[model samples]
Target: MLRARRWSTRLFNLQRQGRMGTTAPIDGEEAAVVGSAAAMDPAVDWAVPQYREPVGLSRFGDRVLLHTILYHLGHPDAGAYPPDIHVFPTQISIAAQIPHAVGLAWGLRLRGEPGAVLCYFGDGATSEGDFYEAANLAGVVRAPVILLCVNNSWAISTPVRLQTAAGSIADKAAAAGIPGVRVDGNDVVAVREATAAARRRALAGEGPTLIEAVTYRMGPHTTADDPTRYVPPEELAAWAERDPIARLGTRLEQAGLWDDDRQRAAEEDADRRFDAAFDAAQATPLRDDVFIDTAYASPTPQLERQRRLLHDERSRGAG
Candidate 1:
């Protein structure tokens, strides 16, 4: 998982260099994101991420090149519910994907599929109506889902203080009559254990669990953001002391799982892999957008006309 953080740093640099489009930086929340994902079984668990979960997706698909393509293009079809995976396409809306994740868990329970769903969202998403509705329904139906909210201090530019008066986001689970847990988001072991426990409860038909990971966003919200404008320099410096990688590195060193030599080799390998993947993503041919095939069944006349217009627009752009 620390390796993933390293790769994301390079990816962020690429985005900064204008080799990519929009990106949501996941620098400080790597443990919260990757640790939770590492606990999920890709074969049966499902993840609905809100634009900032590439590290989690890496747990499911180690195909760095494919993920590179997905991130670089940011195409609609790229996230159109790809087949047979634990993760879905990156969500764009604030909290809209929460309901979809609840329904997925509910449907899986209805079909007796024994599959659980994991949903990721930021602190700001909690203020949205969709979040409450989805939480209520998931609790009522005992949906097998784990709602992992990464409360990374700030939601874009809005800080958590302005978003909710509650002491902790995890406490919100009580309104739905489910378990809520607060963990040190920087502690990878703690996050993993919490997720594993939640997964077990879900599989046992114990309903959903809401987890609030208390972490800080050590960097800008995204490539488009300028943290220096709003975030305090001292605040960033304070969180720097709680760096998840550094914390995890100490643990690994004690366990003999890591050393300076191993760390150096890992960093070099990650850079090499990312460079290759970036080049491959650039070289791979992109098929023209086909809006007509988006609809599963028959399209109405108006829909067909719209699709034609979109296709024409894309064709013109390509030409």
Candidate 2:
């Protein structure tokens, strides 16, 4: 979770300095991300992500949290992973990956696969039709999928109250006839336990689970956003009291798992990694096929033509 904070901070700053592509800030939501991922076996489970889930996806093929930066920087193949990596490119549209999770889970069951699928989305997504559809389908088919909703209390500039009428986002799961759990999003252990319980139920053929991780987002939706305009300073300060990493660190410290020396070492190790990743990302040759390569598979007929045209243009420029 500390590493995720460092990555998000750097990525957010990179956007401000025009050194990287756009990114969503995950400053205060580290526990929600890490805790949920701690429960799933990435090798067997399919991990699907919406745009802001790079932190959660870290358990799988987040690739040191640099591939997400690479993809945002318009690098082709940055989103690709090995079969066992079981992760796909990040979806930009809100709640877009919800149905994909349902589909993948159902497909896995049909094939007698051994794992469940875990999908992460924001509370704002609960307002979308796809969210309901996916939940309904998973419930009806008994698909082994866990819908992990990070209810950070804000969707871009909009508040959760404006997004839903329910008492809590977890209540939405009641309609789908599945178990819905609302946990302390800032509590790493609670989040992990809730997700693990959900995974167990899914694997036992009890159908889907909806986890409403009640948390807060302490930064802007993106670097381009000005939270000060919509988010009051008092609100930010209030959430600061519940910083997830600090809460977790306190627990670990009590358990004798963390210390000042260990934290210093971890930060130093993180710095070295970021330095290496910066060099690697910059070393890749910019090519005409970069955007085309971002495609998940063989380019469609139209995309192939586009790639050819780009190649020819680059060739002409070189000539």
Which prediction has the highest lDDT against the true structure?
2
Candidate with best TM-score: 2
**What lDDT does model 2 reach?**
0.86
**lDDT for each of the candidates?**
0.82, 0.86
What does candidate 1's lDDT look like per residue over 159-182, in tens digits? 899999998899899888889999
Cα error of candidate 1 at position 132, Å: 0.7
lDDT value for model 1: 0.82
Model 2 agreement with the true structure over 124-202: per-residue lDDT tens digits: 9999999999999999999999999999999999999999889999999999988889999999999999999999999
Angstrom error at residue 269, model 2: 1.5
Q: Which ten residues in a row have the lowest lDDT in candidate 1?
A: 73-82
Q: Where does model 2 exceed 4 Å of error?
A: 61-64, 290-319
